[model samples]
Target: MQAEPCDQEEPPSVLWGLDPIFSAHARLYVRDILQMKESCQVPGIYFYRFHPIFTVDVLGTVVYRRERDDFFCYGVDDGTGVINCLCWKDEQWKQQNEHVKSAPRSLASSHGGFNPVEQLKKLQQAQRSRSQLEIGDVLRVRGPVQTSVQGQREIMASTYYKVEDPVMAVQISWMLELPQLYRKFYDRCFQMQESDLTDSAQSAPALLGRASGLLKDFLREKAVERFRPYDLLQKLVPLIPDIPPEPSTQQEPTPQSSSKQLHQLLRETLQLLQDEGLVFRKVISQDPVYQVTELDKELHRVTRDIIREDSKREKYAEKGCHVLHVLSAVRQRYCPNVSKVVIEVVLKILECNSEIISTTDSHYIVL
Candidate 1:
């Protein structure tokens, strides 16, 4: 029987490198890795379904070995297939091993007491011995996939070490994890929503308006009170307009260009939302997370109450309550981590809802 053709369209090559999965080391069978498709646009990059992979982690037994001056090449067989792994030697460790071997035997007791430097040298020699592999020994290797001069696919190992799994526990764990990874991430097709494609021809303001509306709808539907940028980025990626290639050059967009466009759109949309009193960040952080203003009902109530009660105070009631006074009161009554920006947003929201009115630019009173 023949396999059915996939209906999903492949995402643009420029977006391939933006995916976090491409940065991680994929755990795949040697046979599958060898058979995977290589990207014509970016050589040395392989794809397993929609997943772009360059590095892989493999656990197998060494079936063959060849020594070089600076590196050792081993044929690793994980039962499915055999692939060559080029493991580089550590020059410092090699030198330490040589020094220990050449040292005089009488040096062991020459001090007639405990010698810390000599003991450290002995430890380094033992580590060097463990790293050296023989045929039939279990080995684990991780590195980027590359094509050798002979046109054979191999791994240029960044890390390689001998495994001592006497009872095969490590192998069994790896066997179980591979299938889960494939089912969850590797096997799935990268697809964009049809609705997003339909809006691709829309203007920039229209696109931002639609994205903001979608985010509002999502928060309402999901009842998300607080969220990080990543939680909403995936939902907005499809809305990013595809820029047409120049007719003169017909050059494809680079990964950096596409990624920058996506982030730029998201940043503009988020800033718009903040200006409209729809969302605010509670704390300044390298990784900023936002809170949906309308979703936090308790904050709105507490903010309104602070203005209502403080407005009636007799400290020359002509000006009502200052923004700073409300901020201090809200911090004590509500969450202490709330920022001045959050209070400003909340005050704007309450004012818009007719729950309060601004007595001055920096003061508010309950209506």
Candidate 2:
């Protein structure tokens, strides 16, 4: 977001665009829900507190699900802002509950959080198909108040999108929507075979990406998020540890034990990363030497971008993040001699040689 100089008596330039609406912090995005603790008080950044948005996964059957509140949609009207229209596809869940398990107010928060009145009204709505509920149909809903688009107020959809079946929709929201981004990130860890480290172009931001953003957020979150193949790839690339260009070694060499180890570890960690699902942007290719394939190089680029992106976030700040972290960790876990090369490659990530950094790609940011 760009801001121009203001006239006399005007506010600082920080008050413009998404900067004011989203502060950076290690965070995990599950489905549409974003989970993160405020890392710093960035001026003009929105939401000092962490808020979760639960999309209406199964609205058709559950629209009839009412809450303690009498209103059909949980009656939250934020003055003139957007309203969230939520539908619950309750038919399946209602049946899924053990016969002994009567419909509790809100899933686990048995005490309150879920209003029976609201659930009841939603049930009626489901019966009426008022919020556009249909079996095997998906609906895009907004949040903050229950009857979002239903109301005349302007509302941004924190929860919007459609899925085919209720079960699939729930899976999409719980695992695919927001969390899948990191899976693609983890997948990039293996962009090259376990043998591509000898290739010069394979290196990307090899360390910083491993240390920040969504990956970190995933490691820190209490819940597991989903993975979407495409979005995950797009978002994950930026969070990897892409490095600056290394002097070309035209004749590629064979992989060493250290190189193999790096690939093996990277592959394993990446798989674990998929399991971890949601995470911050901090990333590093624990074994850069083994991932020199063309695919690995792209992974490297993404890692660098995400690392930089996380740093620019209000919470990250540009300090105490470097290749040393990954190398040290690698050394502690396995080989000492190999980490030296890794250390060198890592240095390349931050070495701002615009002359060496590729200008071929439009997406790459040359610093």
Candidate number with greatest lDDT: 1
For model 2, where is the 10-residue window of minimal lDDT? 45-54
RMSD to truth, every model: 21.0, 21.6
Model 2: CA > 4 A from native: 1-34, 42-139, 142-180, 185-367
lDDT of 2: 0.33
Q: TM-score, each model?
A: 0.48, 0.22
Tell me the tens digit of each residue's lDDT in model 1 across 86-160: 999888976676777787777657778766458977788677766789999999999999988897989999998
Worst ten-residue run, lDDT, model 1? 3-12
Positional deviation of residue 103's Cα in model 2 after best superposition, in angstroms = 44
Q: How many steric clashes between backbone atoms does each model show? A: 0, 86
